[model samples]
Target: MDSQQPKQPKVLWLNVIVFTVTFAVAAIGTPLWAWHHGFDLAQFIMLGVAFTFTGMSITAGYHRLWSHKAYEANSVLKVIFALGGAFAIQNSILHWASDHRIHHRHVDDNDVDPYSANRGFWYSHIGWMLRDYQRNRYADYTNCRDLQKDKIVMWQHKYYLPLVLLTNFGIPLVFGVLHGDIWGALILIGFTRLVLNHHTTFFINSLAHIWGKQPYTNKNSARDNGFLALLTFGEGYHNFHHIFENDYRNGIHWWQFDPTKWLIKAGSWVGLTTKLRITPEERIEKAKATMLLTRLKTRLSVSDENQRRIQLIQFEYDALLARMTDYYAMKKRFFDLKKRRLLKKYERADLLNQLQKMKSELQQQRKTWYSLAASYSY
Candidate 1:
């Protein structure tokens, strides 16, 4: 078969029909009905609350906790996430994590990647789900063996249909009845909230790859965009997440809008989450430095500069990277020594002295590295 004209898998009529009808209801029905009979403040408020719960479930629970094992959540939290996942109307945790693992493992490969963004925006965003392009891929969820072992995950997968109906409809109906407006709640919270959640999550696979800066690595299409992160519950930091998949936080900085990371951290305080994985700060800085050096080299390659000048800059870049490597190595050793000191009954003065010396050396090395890096721009 021609590479461009690959065999089209069977169409998923259920998904096709559901997405179409819901989208129509959200787009046309919402405006028409609202215009005729405006929904009350309570219904709008319910939509916002429902959106937050379901969206965070996917980000903090499914994506970070289950899919990447970035952190461990207690059984109660897991059950809550399961219910939220069903309410969000995404597939079962097993299936969602399986496709995600494949996407990360074979990103940009149209043949294997369940939703290769390189195919096009629409295709990556929603087209992949519309057609059964990889029917067996979803069925063969061996990639999600770890998740399958999770009781909450397995239980949700086994009873996903009933749970979906219960959360999606039951919750809305209950809220509507309490608010004395079943139709209003269903339209606002049910249709509008679901449609918004679906599209925002889909943006990570589509727009995240297309727009934004690739500061960490350009090996794949993923890019980091703060704007997208705000919409997708901090998933907009796609480039960082792609490079540091196991890190519990996508938005590494404190100021980054990663509510999911905040939720996970908050859960830990109450014994609801544990073992949150985090990338070392030095490693993240090193990745950024390496990408900068790569960019500079590419620029020099296409420049009409003197050979001697280019060689000089290249030498400086290599030296800075070597210094950075040494600094991180020393820092690692210092941390290891500190860990040993804390764990062991006896604390040696000499060990503490050595750690302090290493820490000072690392600080000096970091200063030198930054100075050298700054010189390149001049």
Candidate 2:
């Protein structure tokens, strides 16, 4: 008898039609309409507004707030995100978060990961959605039990289809009525915005894995790409995200283009969000230092006169990590004392001085380590 072949999952014609129709309208219909009818400033503005709102909803609301629980959001804020997520047409929070949690847990596992990039770019990007590859697991939202407790998340899940219809059509129709350009609003704000949101978010799954540097880790295919960050509302820092999955901020530098982080931070000021989780600076620095030292060690191993160079590099690495440990330890103590409000004025001043001195010493050690690491890169 011949061995049985595994059955392929059937194609989801609804997903195919939705993806095909929206893309066709956005790419082909939009420009053709614009060439004859022309777009005004308001139409373009509506496009920009819709695009930003929906993208932020996905990055900040869906990925960070619901999926990772990186921070706590108030009921009102959660409601807005729920509505915006529906408008974005990326599925309900329960479904998206369930898939995302699985993706993180089994990232590159082709057989398990929902959008495993290891399967190839097209599959990770959009092909995963075009079929019933998940089978009965489509309704298996066990990973999202916490999100199920949130009234906003549950309401969205229960009424998701109607919510999708309401926001997707209602917003565009409202914009159309107000702007007195119904077709222009639908084409630009509705179809075009949807296409852009879908693909750019998909880039985080596909291109983010294929391109950019893996400064934090190489365990998975995820990489950090600045250009993708700009396109995806600051989600391009995928390497960091994979390792530090619960950190509310992806682009952890002040100069990085993480508007999503900024929006969440801004919300905290008005009490819209709280308990924003972050990876400690010590942990982040240690990761970078470890990766750099590994590369330096590899490069040095190839040199004929590497004994002394290797010894020096090892010495610097040890010293840097030691100083880092002490600095963060003292910094933590300083904060604890400050928070408790039990320190005498002079004692507080003494601790502050100690922290400053340790910080300066750590900075000097870091500079020496980096200088040494850079010299051997060639």
Candidate 3:
């Protein structure tokens, strides 16, 4: 049955009310409040702090740490994340991770994926939350057995409501009273920040699929949008994320705006995080090259002259792959031997020289392959 015309599910009045009220306050009330009494520096500073805590909690703590096990954090970090997750008002870690795991397992399936983007914008964005679409699985968190084992995760789940109320209202009210402007704190830190966070997170479900380029793979609707990454705390590299779901870094490149990745990495320096997982560069490169070759092949198949270009491209691509395989293989071996501490100093030096040579050759071949692909006119 199409989600568009399916039997209507019971509307979750609580969610509807919460979403509607918060949005109204943020949209209408904030401006009105600002009109009467201007926002202060304290309120703005608190808003940034509150937003960062909640946003990073969701991206780094909920999504990467729990949903994908992309990295591990210490107990102290876990507790902070738990509190921040409650502050974010998304859901219990168990529920969020379970739903997310299911979504990945059945990405495009309307009947299975909790927020299947194929169902259209509104449905994927917020409509799914407006109704009891997965009532049967509301309490069935079998998918999050790992999260269930974590004490902080279970504790947060047990006290989520109280935590939510405290962090959302209590904390904001405190900041307001302390700053001598209770209403401003509530408007900016409490409502406005929540509204912005909600929609930005929702954009990953809706706009992320609808917009952006698919540089990695078109196997799914996920896309890589840098602008979205900036808004979502670095979750906008959707295409790369879908393919390398377990990788700790969504934006693999240093230039990419993945603050969550940086935060996790910095945590490692302080012993707050460890075992950050990353996809092998060889695998990432191959996936990219395969996608590029597949696209070019489709374009080249349109004409005989273009068809000839395919062979040349294939040759260069194959050579590049060969170089990549050799370079990575030697590099891995060099590291493995070094780790074992069994290699003589001279043997290590010889291996290091060979690895550098292979790396240089690989780089040259990559440039040549890309140049060859670009040489042919469409």
User: Which is the winner by lDDT between candidate 1 and candidate 2?
Assistant: 2
lDDT by residue (1-378, candidate 2, tens digit) is: 999998878999999999999999999999899899999998998899999999999999999999998999999988988999999999999999988998999999999999999999999999999999888775658887787778889899999999999989999999899889898888999999999999999999999999999898878999999999999999999999999999999999999999999999999999999999999999999988988888778777656579789889999999999999999999999999889998899999999999999999999999999999889899
Ranking by lDDT: 2, 3, 1
Candidate 3: residue 162 Cα off by (Å): 1.0
lDDT string, candidate 3, 1-378, tens digits: 646766889999999999999999999999999999999787888888999999999999999999999999999998999899898899999999999999999998999999999999999999999999998896658888778889999999999999999999998998888889887888899999999888999999999998998888989999999999999999999999999999999999999999999999999999999999989999999989888888888766557787678888889899999999999999999889889998999999999999999999999999998887776635
Using all chains and alpha carbons, the TM-scores for the candidates as numbered come to 0.90, 0.96, 0.96
Best by lDDT: 2
* Tens digits of lDDT, candidate 1, 144-177: 8777778999999999999999999999999989
Better of 1 and 2 by TM-score: 2
Position 230, candidate 1: lDDT: 92
lDDT of each: 0.87, 0.93, 0.92
The TM-score between candidate 2 and the true structure equals 0.96
Model 3: lDDT of residue 243: 95
Candidate 2 ranges with C-alpha deviation above 4 Å: 1-6, 302-304
Cα distance off (Å), candidate 2, residue 158: 0.9
